[model samples]
Target: MRELIKEAIVDLKRNDGFIYVTAEGKKIDLHEAAARGIAVTPVNPKDQVIKKLESAGLHLTDNKFVADLNELISVLNGGGSSKSAGKRRSFSDDEKSKILEEWQKVEAAGKKTKAAFAREIGVGYQTFINWLRG
Candidate 1:
C-alpha cells in the first residue's frame, strides 16, 4: 500500500498542473486532481467533525457517531419520535460500466429481460433501462 501511494504521488507530480511543492511546503489543487481522477472524493462534513473531535481526545466509530447524532436530534425534539434517515445511492463511472457489462451478459443469454438484469444488479428496472439508454 505504501509503494502504491508513493507511485500515485509520483504520478501526481508528473501531472505538474495539479500538484506543487512550494518553499514553505507541499500544495495540492483538489479540483484539478479530481478532474484528472487522481483524488476524487465527496466533501464529507462528518470526517471534518470527527477530526475536530479527535483533537479533544474523543474517538468515534461511524456507528457511534451516527447514534450520537440521532440522540442529539432526539434531545432537540424534546423526546419526540425520530424520523428514519434515508440515503440516496450513487455509482461511480467504473461501477456503472461494470453494471452495463453485467447487463450485456444477461442479454447474451437465451432470455433478455431488463427486469431480471436490474434485479441481478440491485437496481430498479426503470433505473437500469434509463442507464442503458444513457
Candidate 2:
C-alpha cells in the first residue's frame, strides 16, 4: 500500500495509517494532498480510500473522546490524573426507593413503560433496567 501510494500519489508517503505529504514543512493528509493535484488512486471507490485513511485525524468514532478530553483538562488543572469527571452518579437510598416504587406502579398499570420511566428519571433505559435487577 505504501509503495502503491508513493508511486501513485506524488510526494505522499503512508505514515501511521495515513498518507501524508510535506507541504511548506508541515504534513497534511492524503485527501488534502490530492486536492492539491497530488496523485492518489482516482479510479478506486471513495469508501475504500477512506478506510485506507482510517484513524489519522480528529475524527474519534468512539464516545470516549469527551471523557478523555475532560481527563486531560483535569490533569492540566492540577487535579489528580487518576480522577474521573463524574462518570457515574449515585442516588440516595430514598431516591432509589422512590424510583423503584414509581417504576412498579407504571408496570402494574400497563402504562408508561420502562423507556418512559427512564426518560422521566433522566437516565438511560439500560440503567433503569439495571436498577430493577437490583
Candidate 3:
C-alpha cells in the first residue's frame, strides 16, 4: 500500500490542491482523502477540489452560531463555561485556614476525601494537600 501510494503521487505530479499524506505514507487525491475519513478541509481557490470539499461540513461550521442569548437566559445564568462547572475561584490563607478548619470536620465525618473537600473549598488537590502539610 505504501509503495502503491508513493507510485501514485509520483504519477499524479501536481501539488496545487489539498494533498493528504496519510499515516501510512500514502498520498491521496483530494476526493479520495475526503472519502477515506477525517475532517481536514483545505481550500485554495485556484485548486479545483475547493468547491466540492467546501460543501463537506468544514466551511459550514465556520458560520454556525453555538447558541442564542435567549437560550442563555432560559437555561444557564449568562452561560459561563461548562468546563469550569464544579471549579470555584481562589481564596487567601486566612480564608483558607478557616475553610480547612471546617474541612477537617468534614473529613472527621469521613464521607468526603481531601480532594472532594478541596473542590468544595475551591483550592486545587495539591494546594489542599500543601495546606494540610503546613
Best-fitting candidate, scored by TM-score? 1
Error of 1 at 89 (Å): 2.0
Pitting candidate 1 against candidate 2, the one with the higher lDDT is 2
In the range 49-101, model 3's lDDT, one tens digit per residue, is 33333444223223332233344454567656554468665678898789878
Summing lDDT over every window of 10 consecutive residues in candidate 3, give the lowest-scoring window. 57-66
Q: How accurate is candidate 3 locally (lDDT)?
A: 0.60
Q: Is candidate 1 or candidate 3 better by TM-score?
A: 1
* Tens-digit lDDT string for candidate 1 (1-134): 45544544454445333333233433445666556556333323344445545565445556776687777779788884344345345788899998898778778884768887678667788888888998
Off by over 4 Å in 1: 1-86
Cα lDDT computed for each candidate against the true fold: 0.61, 0.63, 0.60
lDDT tens per residue, model 2, 74-130? 888989656544556578878988999988888999989789879888888898888
Model 1 earns a TM-score of 0.37
TM-score of each: 0.37, 0.34, 0.33
For model 2, which pairs clash? Answer: 9-39
What is candidate 2's local distance difference test score? 0.63
Error of 3 at 58 (Å): 52
lDDT of 1 at 78: 81
Once all C-alphas are superposed, what RMSD does model 1 give against the true structure? 18.2
Q: Which stretches of candidate 2 lie over 4 Å from their true place?
A: 1-88
Clashing pairs in 1: none
